[model samples]
Target: MKQILIAEDEPDIQELLCAYLEDAGYRTTVAGDGAQALAVFGGQPFDLVLLDLMLPGIDGFGVCEVIRRQSQVPILMLTALDGEESQLRGFGLDIDDYVTKPFSMPVLLEKIRVILRRRGLAGPESRLHYRDLSLDLDTREVLLAGRPLELTAREFELLHTFLAAPGRVFTREMLLARLWGYDFYGDERVVDSHIKNLRHKLGRNYIETVRGVGYRAAKADR
Candidate 1:
């Protein structure tokens, strides 16, 4: 499992992030301030860091600077500072990514996924398998029942998302922000359309509709 260090001062947001990240299969440690964050970071290894810029004591930039001087662990800034200057400063510090407050959890999670994958901290050349279906992340290929399955780019991504975490319900909004960019202004039904096509090609049993919620990969075959 990937280890993530979360440095934030807000209790509610810290708890929420811990729950979500743990549910997504990551091991996490929390730091309520920049000083504690640095202390914990020095005590152990971490695959990534979720930093809050407004952290009490030392602040995110200081903590980041301290860490950068020693290691290049990927750092993602989660802050209320959305201004270009703040963002530029974060980039100047070599943060892997920056996310402002009121951000989409799915989008943030996707950003973490991308950063880890890029750094080889996430499973490199990983293959996701659910029963007879397999997705080769490196090759961007999907196979069903040991046979090559052809899919559109969108369809493949949709399936990969599902298989990445079986039984995790993904709301249409979450899927939209994930597959399409967060700024996509298209209708939510576009997800339904792509899912419909994906089901038709990959077999309807592989994905399940969660009534009023959304969709999930059918539970792993027992």
Candidate 2:
């Protein structure tokens, strides 16, 4: 998952931002002030930073300026200020985007999505990562703990669907429809066979049977 640093002082907004970002399948770290943000920035590699302009200590512009001096990490300024000067200044500081307060959370999510995509972190060739497993869509390859995996077409598609939605149960009927299509009048038992084969190839415990439900790619213990 892509990790983001959210530098917003207000506890309410900080909580709200963290909740939304995490719900969107991102790892988030929040800084209550600009200095904390800078500290966190220096300590770790982050995919992006959401900066609040009106912050205690250094302020967002200063943080952006300081970060710009060392790295080209994407920064989006979040502020209640909506003046041309503020926007121009943020842009001048090389901030990727700017958003005023009372912003829609969904819009913020979309902006982050676009920014990450542009940065090639979530683009077409971007690899999907879960645990030590990786799926390269562009190359149609699978890597388990950095080792290459040779999978059949059916197994590949099945594992692909499961990996796409870790922890989400996929019913036999749904799998049949998705993998074999409506025209495949064969027995649903094939789903179990494929799953068994896939599990054998991928570590056996990588997939979990939901007992009465169906199957899901077990969520990795992060």
Candidate 3:
């Protein structure tokens, strides 16, 4: 999974951003100020950074300068600074993209997707494999034990999600939001239905119920 560092002071926006990103399958770390952002950035590798310009200490520019000097990790500036000068300065500092406040979550997600895809950080592989199963991402084909297996679109996505992150239990709500979008008002039990179909098709050993939590991909046997 991709790791994203979010540097924002406002608690509401920080929580909102983290929830959306996590639902979309990215691991996120939060930093309330520029100093904290820098400290977190230096300690580990991250696929991307969501920066807020008006941070409490050091400021976004200072943080960007320090990070730019060390690594080329993609940075997307999320601030209320919409002026041409502010944007020009952010671009000049080598930020991959910039989004002014009051932005739509869908648009922000798309921007993150595009930036990661462009940088080759997104999952661009032709196929995904687990034990005897293989999924062709490009062709939307699945093979089981070297034989072709047919599946519905929802089943394919559910399997793909599970195979992408083995052992990551996905709640029905998370699966619904990620797969069906927030506008989906249908019963959440739809996720259970689809999972049942997938297990029927792929075999029960591939997915395991987490009892109270959700479901995760079963680990390969020794």
**Clashing residue pairs in candidate 1, if any?**
none
Error of 1 at 120 (Å): 6.4
TM-score-better candidate, 1 vs 3: 1
RMSD values, in order shown: 4.5, 11.6, 5.9
| Tens digits of lDDT, candidate 3, 147-206 | 999998778878877887787888887677666754467998889998888889876479
Query: Stretches of candidate 3 above 4 Å error?
Result: 123-222
Model 1 has a clash total of 0
> Per-prediction TM-score, please?
0.67, 0.57, 0.59
Better of 2 and 3 by lDDT: 3
Native-structure RMSD, model 2 = 11.6
Ranking by TM-score: 1, 3, 2
Best of the two (1, 2) by lDDT? 1
Question: Which 10-residue window in model 2 sums to the lowest lDDT?
Answer: 176-185
> Pick by TM-score: which candidate is best?
1
TM-score of candidate 2 against the unseen true structure: 0.57
lDDT of 1: 0.85
Model-by-model lDDT, in order?
A: 0.85, 0.82, 0.85
Q: Write the per-residue lDDT of candidate 2 for residues 1-222, one digit (tens) a residue.
A: 888999999987787677556645788999999899999999999999999999999998899989999999989999999999999999999888999977766457668878887777772224678788887754668999899999987787677667766777878876775666423578999999988998888765888989999998886762
Clashes of each: 0, 0, 0
How far off is residue 104 in model 2, in Å?
0.4
- Candidate 3's TM-score reads 0.59
